[model samples]
Target: MVDADQTFVIVGGGLAGAKAAETLRAEGFTGRVILICDERDHPYERPPLSKGYLLGKEERDSVFVHEPAWYTQAEIELHLGQVVVSIDRYAKSVRLGDGTLIEYDKLLLATGAEPRRLDVPGTDLAGVHHLRRLAHAERLRGVLTSLGRDNGHLVIAGAGWIGLEVAAAAREYGAEVTVVEPLPTPLHSVLGPELGQLFADLHREHGVRFHFGRKLTEILGQDGVVLAARTDDGEEHPAHAVLAAIGAAPRTALAEAAGLTIADRAHGAGIAVDASLRTSDPDIHAAGDVASTLHPLLGFPIRVEHWANALNGGPAAARAMLGQEVTYDRVPYFFSDQYDMGMEYSGWAPPGTYDEVVIRGDVGKRQFIAFWLAEGRVLAGMNVNVWDVTEPIQKLIRSRAQVGPEALSDPSVPLESLAG
Candidate 1:
């Protein structure tokens, strides 16, 4: 029942959109595939922007989802550097910035999120930066190197993953780094106070200064060049460069204009999609950071902005668009690399969701698996400097079986056996 004449339009050129196009072809969809991307560069993964690429460990080509010729060979009409200005759900078409109208039988919105801007004054200064795009990373890489050579100071506004990773990179480059976070500890929301302190300690040991319980109130600069950053506590930090690693907001203007249902702030505040990744309009689907999916297993609507979501969500959405039975309930997963330590966290356990945190292995050595439990049932797990345990950790979460905290903390206990 495949229709060769049918055209599927994908709006967004990030990993999700690119993977969706790849999935369409892999799934034997002979229909016309059109991918519209605002960025001139070919679709690429975003993680390297803050990780390997920023640290100069990865080449520019490594970030791209595919070779430039792959789209041509796959028969995917890739319109790069073209912006989709509007989505006309009624006409089943999208209007580009150049005023080109392209009709579609089904549409996918993979538009990712944009970095949240610092509303404080002097953010427009030359040394103030945000790390959301490849261009930003490219610029930041040189800036960090220059800062390091001159022993210039870097003031980071948040202690989130991006903030910490960039701090690590800056320290590795031999630059002075000071992170300002409003919360009591780094990654306060995700890891909570318990494990959040661990990251704070790790960064501190790497010579990164932390200004906890404070917020960057303003960036002080002269002649449009960042000189220093002022915290809410009235502490002034000399800053040759300032990085706003606060957070990102989903790009949902087109979806909202097209009358698609958007989730509320409490539910991630993104384009609302069912478990199938289908939006309010049956012909339209949303994925990646822009899609707030009502998860079946978690029993809540969640929008994840991690790299893993885009890596998997796009293909899932493509299969759903192909009229295949689909349910996107993959456990939320993310990882971070700082200094000499690398860690992977699986599942969702925001502050109140878990009653206790159990640790296996040694915390002092930074080699351990931390588990969040609620009523003796595993809610989430994080492995620090531990390898080959993500499978069992995910299984434990999926199993939803009650487990003893003592057994969870014991290194002798095999995680696979307890997963049941």
Candidate 2:
């Protein structure tokens, strides 16, 4: 149990930060708990910013982590619109933007990530936007409503999850949408070629156009407002607005400046932490996207940027901060919704490492359970247009059981019965 007089300070204001605060109080941490957030609003979840919230199907208040009164009731002090400028390890204190110093016995870094800005010429134009925060989504919502479905055309650069989901939302708003990707297919690096093609087909069926294998050279604008995008091949795509959804880079500057170990160049830049989520400094812990943790299962350090990691990692880090023994071994998981198709994937293996993809259901009909296997052992699995099977899929990966491809592809075989 934590000492009653000790204080804990949590930096960052995303889901991971909020969850860490909740865990501290629930796990009997009676010490002083302070949550520092740079945003004007309280901690909030970001998934809805691109999906339901952007489409206006969900209310604005629903996205916040908790009602304003929850913090007061829990006795958690909140520092809103305050940036942490420096960390004094020797003094065990943090300096805020306004020149205030907060002392802490233990510190948690949950600084999430920021959207990658396109460096092209016209990206700074008035009509071009990147959706990373609630305010960005709100602006995009206004742009969509004003443009309407038939009145505006949206050119989305990049075909990642954010780009595709935003494309779907734009289509629902009755706007003509076109997506451009440098790769041959969308999500090629993560889902591989065949599964990537399935998503490509799904978008095409919904009247969305694709410009695959092309590089965006410039964004054309008129009077400081975006009007079109020009590719490297001299092709011009006209647009009333542009969404630069290339990707996000983990927010690691604060951790880096604090003298924490960062992952190597190959693994990407993330605050390096152990299985217990403790950084190089024993008193400091990192979680969520900012942490590149040594996975007990994968045998390597990986930084997962999905919602599940923050939802689960926050609690694990909190427990570790209190000197409790814990290991974060959950498989990386993420899902996507585009048009009528919903897909869930669990486990992680780099794209080219898996030898074969075994399909248990029909792929032609767009409903199937696909497994990524290497040397007859299940490494990862995905269920597309299928439901109620994630638990079984995760079991297959965690158990590390070897099964023949014939058995994996056979519909007569039950996923639960196959492992034993």
- Across 123-191, the per-residue lDDT of candidate 2 in tens digits comes to 888999899889999999998886674478899999989999999888888888889999989988778
In angstroms, what RMSD does candidate 1 have relative to the true structure?
1.3
lDDT of 1: 0.95
Q: How close is candidate 1 to the true structure, as a TM-score?
A: 0.99
Off by over 4 Å in 1: 1-4
Best by lDDT: 1
lDDT: worst 10-residue window of model 1: 1-10
Instruction: Go through the candidates in order and give each one's C-alpha lDDT.
Output: 0.95, 0.90
Would you estimate the TM-scores of all the predictions?
Answer: 0.99, 0.97
Tens-digit lDDT string for candidate 1 (84-130): 99988888999999999999999999999999999998998999999
Give the distance in Å from residue 361's predicted Cα in candidate 2 to where it truly belongs. Answer: 1.1
